[model samples]
Target chain A: MANIKIIQGDFQQRLKLQFAPGIKAGFPSPADDYSHETLDFNRDLILNPEATFYGKVEGDSMIEAGICDGDIAVIDRSIEPRDGDVVVGYINDEFTIKYLDLRHRKDGYIELRPANNDFKPIRIREDDDFEVWGVVVWTIKNWRKY
Target chain B: MYGIIDCDNCYVSCERVFRPDLKDKPVVVLSNNDGCVVARSNEAKKMGIKAGTPYFQLAEQFPNQKIAVFSSNYELYGELTGRVVEIIRQEAPAYFRYSIDECFVCFDGFADTNLKEWGENLHKRILRSVGMPVSIGIAPTKTLAKMASHFAKKYEGYRHCCMIDTDEKRIKALKLYPIGEVWGIGRRYAARLEALGVKTAFDLANHNETWVKATFNNIVIERTWRELNGIDCVPNEEMAKKKSICTSRSFNGMITDLDGLRTHVSNHAARCAEKLRQQGTVATIVGVFLNTNAFREDLPQRCSFQETLLTNPSNSTITIVKAANEVLQKLYRQGYHYKKAGVIVMGIGPDSPYQPDLFDFNAEQFEKMKRLDAVVDRINKVNGTASIVLGSQQYTRKNGKGKADVVARSARRDACQSKNAIKQDFKSKNPTTRWSDIITLK
Candidate 1:
């Protein structure tokens, strides 16, 4: 029995410390029945872990839409892009963040509308090699500026 | 029923995820050290780009063709494939990853379900979520499911999902499948089977058990025959116990000294030990292999491998690294330029409650080693990989551009890197894993 030891599931082991949650501290609190896990961005906010990707915003492409440079965009490829949705599109060998404007579908071409007035709208003639790479689900901004 | 989902052209497909422009283009990914083509896209396959074609020969053979080339980036491949596996984890009733690109699922209770539609929808979901195209195969046994996946990849009519549910379908699939391609029937057995006038899976399945037993007395071949005849004989334990862990790398350049070779072997040995501990296993043997580049015909060529048995099977990095260095000392030749080297840990089994020899059992030291290893594993996980590597594992590395952020702690840190850092000149960005390399949206 010299070589006996614990094995398997070594990663999920936790410290055997005791603050004693079961000690009935302060009358067990009134909200004990409804206690649950806290909200985590990785688990709750991101619905599709497989399809989620992140991109850093640049060039003030969507500045008027409150999506500024240095912000992080959470893109979900599994989501369907709809009219007035902020989406990432690949064009001219780069990813451009823009609003998907499908209101002109009867005119035989859709447009990638920009949020800032300084930038012009990019239109497709229905013959171009183009696709909306992913839809923007959320954007995180750093207000404190580290 | 059993289902196998295999990533189509796995490494090349991983490379194409970030670069959507590479779609419909001829692309191939090279092995470590930019050695040779290990993966080829369908378009590249159509252009007759064979796997294992050396890097230099690609330009010579296809003079005027436009083909995309990539160095194998396992970080990207592993991350992307992990996403695919995550989707499978959500969709499949029960599954286990067979390899990096293949996953086996047991559809035990879904008797009334439409497996074909289920497989098709699974494929669609994976492709949609991960941008990875996978082929699905469903059958009564694992072997037949693997064979069906091949048909799903070959013919478009299967819609990336093939099922061998009926006897007629199984018989037809067996007839069309070549003998050499059958699972568990390796090359040696395939040659023996072909010599006996058995050329297809159907040929082996059609023979009676007495003939199979009389012809080949091997149990593995017999199991293949039985599985081909619709018997489920493959065990999950065979998949669970990896049996061996091999870590090898072709150097960026050849090495002529024993010291440099020792560093490479120690790194590989340490890697093998880490892998063993991660899987909660221990290895009873430590093997080392050294070889010269066969392509350099002008120079002398030599290749050899030798292993040493341990007094006690161990997964400790120091123990394995020391054993590997001892073997390397015997295997090394003074004047040969070694191009590649590797360490293999075999005879692997569960680490808990191992038997110890009466003469070599040291209980106190074993406890110390376990505590040390656990702390090292934790430190490496938090600070980043290889942060507290063994002294023997330390080697000065070439500063490949864009990777100049080596921690500055000592004079050794500032010293130039070892000459044999792997040559991955065409490795793409790790946009998915690294924050500094994430995609830029304009």
Candidate 2:
């Protein structure tokens, strides 16, 4: 019963943060004028605004892939899911984040491999209702905010 | 060539995006107020469920079958439609959104390219991007393109894209396409054409142009005949400004009180004004109508309508709501259970550089109102609808109370909140538009 709700991202009010030069532990270098260029996070991260969707991770099955519980997964439907790519897939009408394995695809079946060793690889039968919803482009975890 | 990309079972497809479990199951989307079936999945269609069939009839029709039913969620469908349109805009050189579920694209420069392959890629791109299946039909004319789209949807062999590029293919396609199924031809014209031995599109194309023109005496049918013959008679439809705008809805339950009716009327009026501003148009006339349920024979039925002409055209929500409220007051009748109310703004024209009123001219007041409307529209657009509405439109419902008591409490609350209060019970979430409804995994 996990329904993915997609909200449109506001691109007009983009925040551009200045990338200040890093300070070394050995010595602190003078701030360079070249480091004043600001970066637009939305432009850098989101390749396709219309096709990109954000979903929160629920289970720990994909913890090995750095997509832990409560992490936000950026799924891009525009990008084709390649073999071994982390993908958000719909199986039996439920969404699951897993590694897509195409090695055994020629045998007329696909495999959804969970990142965590605790979970077993799911063998997708030809008769099973399944689809690759999108490729997980990025994952954002709230390290210290929470 | 013009290509039409139409989402297959649009409303059903939208619902499936959220509830994939509905796949391979009989699903039906009900119309407003959960009255009748507005859309049905392929399985539902196979089960003999028809569009506009009353929701109550489903049980009688399929006694033992499991069926998934959903009320019309326009907010979700509208957002998904926008996403689909955005994808189309990026893929096609130029496009016209024909409707919520369909778009017409022109392939002007890519004449020598592999059109069939291009169509397939477009189909796959939309499906992958939006999770909605679309059928594409490419032809020399819009009418023919529409006909080709029908074939693309009907036959699986087409692989969701059917292109009629050559004259031979055009003739063959037209031969199989019925006159009734042609783009612009309605039932009346279809019957008349069939009586005149025009059973198929091929037959219509074979007739003499002069004879067809003299027989039908309609420019639209003439254009269709020309289009069937591989001539692009219908140009790309331009987005034209509307002459009038209306916002109306049938309530979930009947209301007998005048204040209750006023709430819905003001809401409709505000929507009409918002639409006018969206289109950069102003209305010179405002109309309001209220009607009792026609199906309730046991109750006394009454219907009334009234309109007011403004001295100066305006797109202001306050002005429109005031006019609508005045008309609603005039149309209101006691001892009637009103089932529906509506507001319409007519005499629409360009909003800018309007002629001021001769007797009553107030520039400062108009400026202030315009600024207020702009702020309200911006807030509502960014925060989802009803972030701010007319004070008269506020309504409240008491929780944990009996039906009769709840109604009485709501009436009292409405009277007190009419000055200024915000109360809403929007059961359906605007997931795409509202930040609060965004999905969170638990």
Candidate 3:
């Protein structure tokens, strides 16, 4: 027998969208039987609220990665970043978002590979005063702005 | 055993959360109204920037230095520190926040756990999750734990967590610790102790209980002596909670009129009530204090404080504000330039289970006020703060239109800025709290 487990998200936070405040408390409504909680973005999306932060992308360095300018990136600082993960790093006294390349760690350095061809990958030496600020979890796109 | 985790240079570290580039650089956070330096980074301290140095004196004291100065941005600090507290809530088996930057973790059930490793891992978790570095100290007593935290911060060899478990280790640490630096020992007591040749913590701890009582005749000093000797005597501060909550700040400038004083006092009282509601407590005594600038030697100076008792212990903003304003009326004096005003609420207790006064307790009205407060708090929380504030809480700042409007940080940036315009010119961006102020990644 094969034991397979599918991820099931159980959102414990329920928002009663069908009801309004100041309704008379006597005689429960028949609508109560069909009441279902509305979806909550905070509960469903943010796995770790304490470690979450938002940063706005400024340029096309990550355009090829579907992370573009004017997009909002959700970063999680608590996660231990891994190879090939889109991470936010502090380089040249500015925050840079790129794919972390750990393939060259055996040679005493790693690279932050940019998605677009116009930008060069940032090479960080073993002794560089650098750290992965956070791992990019989600990038929000504004489809139509009024 | 008890462990104390304290944030290193709390305000400076909070400012550095958004400005990652400022790490390992000279940074200082000024107090309210940018009056004086309240917190300094390690680099700034190395550059001889002393605490309480006025904002105007920084350039004069250290000429041509690249020092980053920031006005106190408590909104950013509160949000970042809340995240740290959330992390601590998950990591420690049992913990209580002592202050905005300090938390105490109790190891009552875990006898076999490695306390030092636990502290180190907790520090690492908080540092990564919140970007706020903390030093952990573990000892049998809270006082000793606080001292251990100091050693952990001073010496890199300790690796941000120092534990004093053995008697020999405790004795050695106390011998090296200064008496003035001991927790619960105020500056006056430290000075008096120094005069008696008690320079080191070991000297005070070495004295018998009889000598400590005979010389000092103080319970706090005796408790400090016992804590230094590794006996858990000092009570847990968080369990007791804050005895009194005072919401006070110096005016943007000198205010001479009673109307000006009324406006400021109302805001402070409202803030105190909001804080009380948040803490799920009520205050019975509401007090107001006003003072003239002590530095202005040319002008007449007067300072007065008056308090009034409430008919019923309450956390209602209107009730507290009304009581505070009545006290302010009695304390205000003519012909004095007032520099600061504050509202303090004392005799706090749990909001529920209070014996309401038999004469004034109105159940219907009390319930109405509670519901009203709940709605107001919800509205403010959803729509930024001060959206539904009392009219009296509005500052008497006249805009170009000469019409009164609510002055709050979330509502209008410039309107609130006009209060401390010059001093807050160097205030940093509140990236964590505001959406538009989030960092830009290039």
Candidate 4:
């Protein structure tokens, strides 16, 4: 079975890292401000803390969308799932990581397009069991781990 | 206007979220221990499958129909409910979670925006996000919003979102709505109202307020009547901290041993303490109760209840579980087959700046317990339920043999490590909360 590990990210103890404005590879500049305002990753990445969830991508269906296998997809249910939005959706009782195509102008139907050309797009009928689980707000790619 | 979003067939919907094939089918969710039908889908209701019908009687009720029956999976339901609540929290300016399946939202600043359209969007969002069908009712009062939600669910013309905006619409909706179906009006009041010629919500609303108050002599009824008349009498801040929290469940089978009963009681106590901490409250009294199978006429009947008052109010699971076990010892009967057990924490108060006992206060132990609880709660929050449980709660028959064996220091560690300690055979994967249970695409 393909596994999608969901780890609840802690928002309480947020790490605020100080970043130099422009790091010069040649030499360290003394003119640069020593004490820069700390940037909170939780605040910058997560728009809605309560509604946000982390789902580990299991398949390469949305590889073209930068959500490759083993990547962590940050889903935000609070955000409206719009056309062209990459969404975690349920189709025929199974969940899929796909891009929602609502521009077809079809009544009571929408297309779930897989990013990889190898996979065919799923045309969901109104009567068919389908649901857009949440909109993928951010994708964290693990270059080393994968 | 106030808007109330209520999930249609909440438990069944929660079940259907994982099993889409059960959609439009005769599906019913059984209560704990696979007892009775606690929740039924619309199709099941249409097929005359009544709620509260015993699971065993399903075959007799609908012999030929292939009914999809599932044991109640509260972990999944709770996680999904939290997700829905989170969405509502972000959408509404101000909101109150009235129940697991219902929430009351105030659109205070969105008066200029079309409320009907807004309600529709809210419904669609929830349906899409959580796979739970919710009906939205927008009205001037919470009670009316509830009534409007009933109409939204019952009739397809409303398109899952009904708004009672104008006086004309209110009057029309209320006239069609029976007095019994009104928010706070129960069967007793409905019968009384009917006798007094108040057959519908419209009739009750049109009645003289002073006369109705005098007749009922009840504040809630008076408020309901006022609310029906478009006066928002019910306070929006109705979600108050609970005074008492009780956690109880029926066993899968009758537990004859005291150790088994202790394990269940400790679990309940731990849950109660966790709840108290969630609300930032401490309980002064801890109560435990155990009862033999009431349904079995052949077995000996025994039921016992015991409670103890603590010198210091505490929300620590260790303290509560220790106290609960003491009460459980008092309640436990050797021969009786105990089918159910419960733990109730009462006389709850705010936990901030706890007043220590003058003579018997252990500052070091109190701080230690607080830290212990916080760590356990945090771990459990991130890593599913019961990842780390009290050793006392893990004393099962298969592993520890009995309470006497579990009391041994060496045996306690072994019991805690046992996989069969916490029974969760009926528990569904907590898709939203647990890492392992998250839906995977292949």
Candidate 5:
């Protein structure tokens, strides 16, 4: 039988040592063909070339879109989001999905308005700070039966 | 062109695959044992059958009509759907399951390839391989594709394939189809739009975006309007994980005994905990509830709910069910035939982000118990559900005989062989087990 003992001393060093070939047996490794770290590391490589990876969408404002509480959206980096496009954008390190309100303000400001009435439009603080991850080329929603 | 393929008469098709004798017949799958019409075939609908019509009502309407009705066979439907989607995934570079019956496939930049031919191939493949007929709709936008798919399903001679990519084709299709038939427009919204003189898809498309947005300020509605105009406003997501995991089911019969209630609650808690584990989240609160059939006035009715906080957030079934039992007792009252007993685990957080409890038991006993529970769960999952259950469940089921008998008559007409029912019927009355006897006590 294989030893299933968990060792949690100096995790960084232990993880680094385990990366070496012919490392000693018995570590807190997940039970899979590939280690947890290996899968996390390969996530970048496994991404669809045509698709852009936008992290989790936060808020129930767009629940009618079937994009509920916590859902990760994929946007096509190539497609230019037109009017009414569901775009993933960054506003002060926070990511959100909303209809692109391209109408520039008279005061030299741009805003992205949420579909739900509960949330306010995210006003562009600085032109340099705002970065659109990608235009949402398609939306994949959940099929919850219950 | 984007293609949307929808399964035709899904529940009836699923049933027909198993019972081939019912092919091309007017079949209607009932919600639960001739309760109401949940799924009906094209043949049944032509015979003036309606969805959600009470089975008794349908029987009255079609006294001479041959209607092969069957209870909803979820296992077969789920299994067949898995097979169909597998065939789809094998065919398309990218695919999205819009619903159980419908899936959208990307044929992006198919400049030279014959799109209609491709759709026909997929339709025939699904029909031949899975024993189910599917209609395909191809259009410039997903919304139009969905609309066209519905038309293809309703109409004959479309040869299971319909396309509306060009303006001429789209106009012809829209003129013939109703405005409410569009993917996102529902009855109330359609009525409002119709009140505004927008009676068809062509009229809706002819209206400016400003007016549409003014009427429907929600973002999804605006996207729907855009999609109607041939713009892909909604993007595709590769991985969409579940937000909340719930495990609940109405019991075959009402359970009055406290032990039986606890057993059902434990079972639900365990199932929900497993779901949480599958999603890589740990629930901090377990909500347990019990309710009686509100329609039944013969018995005293009661409904109660209790949410218990966990010391350490976990997805372990043992830990969750222990919490569920505590809530079950607090909610349980005397003399109520409970139709449903359920547990909903919420306040989910990432497993790695949890702060470990200080001054918690690190005793060897606790560690051993966890390891044992893990082993049991692994065995149960691999073998079958309830292949190995807690002793409490066995004791609880023993005490539930009186309540089970009340609903046993209605349950037995299904012509299904439930393993537990056989075991329950065979067991000698009042048979008991002694713990010491296992060791050959003399």
Candidate 6:
């Protein structure tokens, strides 16, 4: 089946009838702790002076490396990823995170390995088919008192 | 000595990876079958939400409190746990991953140094790097270390690590603790221990080893006794090689048709085989089963089990799946609304086991299988699972029911199939954040 989507204003009246009270109350506003500072959307997008951009982590491939889903990642595009350094790479436009393998193959190729054994290692053909977006400089993860 | 380092409230910690706001919230992770609670955060425990309590039951009990209920996001937990293990390996002298949320570390010698300090440093490093809170316990034996770790979990003053190097500390802690709460003492064993007047760790430890072993039916109780006395009884674990692997689940809708049941079994077999190849293991026996709901009184449930032995142990998905299907056929009977179907692989060993029937015509089939497995594995590794899949899983819920590539691609497939795929590792105070991929469905 195709992805499910409903047109805006398509069910405004029906939704209003079903959830009018909830609509008036609005979502239980998250506490100040849950509310993140709003990003300056109007600010001109700019990479760091040293070629870094903070991107939100979307998947768990790098969770083993301590970079978890939804965590903010510090990506340094300028610094070449060394062995064991986690990197965000683009393979055919799909973003992936893995440890960069510097071991030279017979054809002098490189492979990206996920920290978790559950994920298979990715071998990059010597032919320039992949792009290393940036090396991971740091990870911002959640911390809370027990 | 060998020690198991386990995280407290691992799932909740993973969730905190992103939503730091959920720190100290009543959080619980549901079991694989969406059946009951498996892991609970400290806050959840404080709320009296017991582990294995049914989610629906808990919801009824505490409908007002905003308890965070989450499905098991193993992908994220596995990833986070991996990071923790890697960091431990880098810091510790030697270590082996004991389970998804546990590891065994060898901490010997250096009495002059503070073991608690080492543990604090390790915990801080993991939190800084992986974003998870881990409790460490140092004792002379692995079993005692496990107990110490358990003590560390409940006591906030221990600074996330507990060591019971002396008998006084062990005895003091044990007097107040229930005997059933001890590791390796399950409900039945704990009841028996209590009946025998062994009501606490100290009580159990004080018992004669021979009597305890005789009462417990094995050497496990004796080992526990020694561990309590600070005698190193548990051996250092090299690696736990899986003897068998299984894949099973209760259907969202009960399946009564044999064909539908077969398809479900096939799906599980395919998954089990994927796990097999991932672990470099092969199976010699395939077991299949189908059963009706045991709780439902309206229908009488019939259950059947059958197994097939292979001439050659193989990691080939097709080989095992085909065998599992045959077993399913033998076991599946009509007129019964089967609530569950499952596949079990036994006699598992290294993948390169020799084939006894080398001259069989299927030798050519094996060659094709080798190539096919490699190609499928490669493509799925990149594009995600069901980038390719056996056509059999596509039939009607039985005739391969629920087989449409669409439903499979959208929600259910993402929930069921992606588990063994897109593996990522990380650790966090919030288990939900780590397993966000698996929870994305919710």
Question: Which candidate number would show the highest DockQ if scored against the true structure?
Answer: 3
The 0-to-1 C-alpha lDDT of every candidate, in the order given, reads 0.88, 0.82, 0.88, 0.82, 0.68, 0.70
The TM-score of the first chain in every model comes to 0.80, 0.73, 0.78, 0.71, 0.54, 0.60
Candidate 6 per-residue lDDT, tens place, B270-310, comes to 88888888878888899998888988889987878889998
Quick one: ranking by TM-score, best first?
1, 3, 2, 4, 6, 5
DockQ score of each predicted structure, in the order shown: 0.59, 0.34, 0.67, 0.30, 0.01, 0.02
**Model 1 RMSD to the real structure?**
7.6
Identify the runs in model 6 with alpha carbons over 4 angstroms from their true place.
A1-146, B108-113, B173-177, B237-239, B352-371, B395-442
TM-score of each: 0.91, 0.82, 0.90, 0.78, 0.57, 0.67
Comparison by TM-score, 2 against 4, better one: 2
Looking at model 2 chain B, report the run of 10 residues with the lowest lDDT sum.
B418-427
How would you encode candidate 1's per-residue C-alpha lDDT over B363-396 as one tens digit per residue? 8988899899889999876665677877677664
Pairwise lDDT winner, candidates 4 and 6: 4
Interface RMSD of 6: 12.2
Q: Please give the range of 10 consecutive residues that has the lowest summed lDDT in model 5 chain A.
A: A45-54
Fraction of true contacts retained by every candidate, in order, equals 0.77, 0.45, 0.84, 0.39, 0.00, 0.00
Q: Which candidate is the best by TM-score?
A: 1
As a TM-score, model 1 comes out at 0.91
lDDT of 2 by residue, B1-442 (tens): 8899999999889878756677789888887667678899999999899999977898998899998888788788888888999988887888988778998888888544888998898888888887889999999999999999999999999999999999998989999989999998999999999999889999999999999989989998998999988888776633346667888877766888887788789989999999899878999999998989999999999888889998889999999999999999889888999888899999998898888987797899999999999999998877657767776665544342322333432554553344223222222455455545543432
**Using DockQ as the measure, what is the rank order of every candidate, best first?**
3, 1, 2, 4, 6, 5
Docking band of candidate 2: acceptable
Give the per-residue lDDT of model 3 (tens digit) for B233-260: 7666545477799998888789887877
